[model samples]
Target: MKKKITVALLTAAISLSLVACSNKENVSKNEKLEDTVVVYTTHKEEMLEAISDEFTKETGINVEFINLKGELADRVRSEKDNPQADVMFGGDTSTYMQLKEEGLYEKTEPQWKDELDKSFKDSEGYWYGTIKTPVMMFYNKDLLSADKAPKDWSDLTKEEYKDLIVTRDSLSSSMRSTVCALIENNIKTKNEDAAWKYLTDLDKNIKNYYNSGSVMYSAIGKGEAAISIAVLSDIIDNKENNKMPLEIVDAESGSVVITDCVAALKNAPHPNAAAKFVDFVGSAKVQAMIANDFNRIPTLDSALKDSPAWMATDYKAMDVDWDVIGKNQSKWIEKWETDIIDNNKVEKQ
Candidate 1:
């Protein structure tokens, strides 16, 4: 799946190349990217830099972030007996939950364990969430006005948005989590059939589901697609930095908030360093810095005390039972692949 996505992304390199900025900072004479504790991540390069640079500054521990768009859990499972990375960071809660169920984590209590919301951390000390981000619809300002654009999930199926939508593969944790939330919402409302029907129709409007988040966002920025189902933070950051003609709309049914997590791998090459990194990231200081600068909702309650105006402390999010979703995700993904994606034949731009 990762290889397939990589190939598809190659064609969009012209547009997506602008998405990443050089994060290389001059390391001290003794520092090198190769010497850092290895971390497997799905975080954007810039975000990884922001957290890593701060971690290095605070602890003098060089951090090497290996950003993977897909196959994080699969890779971890394959390397379970002999781990390749010290920690897994930046995948959604569902991914961590699945990993935990597979016994892929090394249970250890971090210093900031008590500081996090119980819902944001594993009861068995497997994984800890750093922040939560909403799944939202981002539309191109050049293609549609605010009044004319889709405001919610249901709006995407309307005729106006046909063939103008772009999104990440349903297998991506972020996209899968969002779809799981929508399905759960429908089940709660006793509209299971309607939910599947809505997804089938929405699939008609999507030009293609890209292999990576950067390419998906880049497609929207370059006007290759008018709308994208992605994280609100990605849309905001891209608009602010790339000056893309994009606007975010929270779904009317409330957004699905995905908790990004960090965890120590079993038989980790650098257990102490991984534990230290986990504690430092979830600490009040780093949490507040991330919340203020990146617009991510801090997982620690105290971190919100000084949150910026853009961060909403009291917003209604769709309630999702992550454990249940984690258990059934493979089944759901299989259904999605056969029923929605394979069944729909849309031409890619």
Candidate 2:
């Protein structure tokens, strides 16, 4: 009887030990999953690193990022069957809309979703805008005074400004937004032909089309080109940080404000980490930090309040329908590339 009792006690002890071991293994797996997040971004490296560092400090989750620039959207699409990144950060709302239509984004509402305006986010909570980037014209102040600089998009096509303008390649989202806004505006007021005519004339003055923003910035700074169009944030950064002789041209037609957005991938390798990252990036606190630190215009109302005083400088916003632009973006881009860019007779100066 004594031997049987001892044997029963040993069996109970072994079962408890096995159960504890299984629970520990489960906990270890979860911890490993939450420790790091992989991100694919189109944002500049400095801004990405700054935001990533802050997120790491706050959440203790490491960030590994790839700056894919123009290739970001295509890469995401190619990897739809098996996603490698946890999050997709940067790129304008229009791109996000296209991706959302393809069902590539995971619908996860960040905590700060309610703080943004309806225009800044998707109604279905697929993606959230973190920055408001205005696509506007700017010039090298040393080369041309405010009075002489192009006051509107039409001014670039003038005979006097010929060979004085440098433009980004059409692949740039900023350039696409600017061109689409002009096209949409013409479609509303006149007809599509009017928009094409304007673009064709504008192309006549182009000294060169640069595939890299940095190269274009250098060309303007060095007086190789006197005027160009760029996002307001980049203009400010080049002027203030890099000491580039740049000035903003508040176009009479107003600027097209691109809502730069963030979203998690549909079958992300680290889903929990991706959800946390999406929430953390668009949070009011981080938004405000980005605004103050990087000269970015925050999309969140509360964050906008904490932004720099320059953000309060009022300028007219182009009255273009973003939904319409999002839907026909590919078609417009294709036509522009084939007709305007490819077939242009203008020789680079």
Number of backbone collisions per candidate = 0, 0
lDDT of 2: 0.80
C-alpha TM-scores of all predictions:
0.79, 0.85
lDDT per residue (tens digit) for residues 95-117 in model 2 = 89899999999989788888789
Question: How well is each residue in 182-257 modelled by candidate 1, as lDDT tens digits?
Answer: 7766666777788788788888888888766777777777778788887776777788777888877766777889
Residue pairs with colliding backbones in model 2 are none
lDDT of each: 0.75, 0.80
* Backbone-clash count (model 2): 0
- Leading candidate by TM-score: 2
What is candidate 2's TM-score against the reference?
0.85
Clashing pairs in 1: none
Question: RMSD in Å for candidate 2, one decimal?
Answer: 11.7
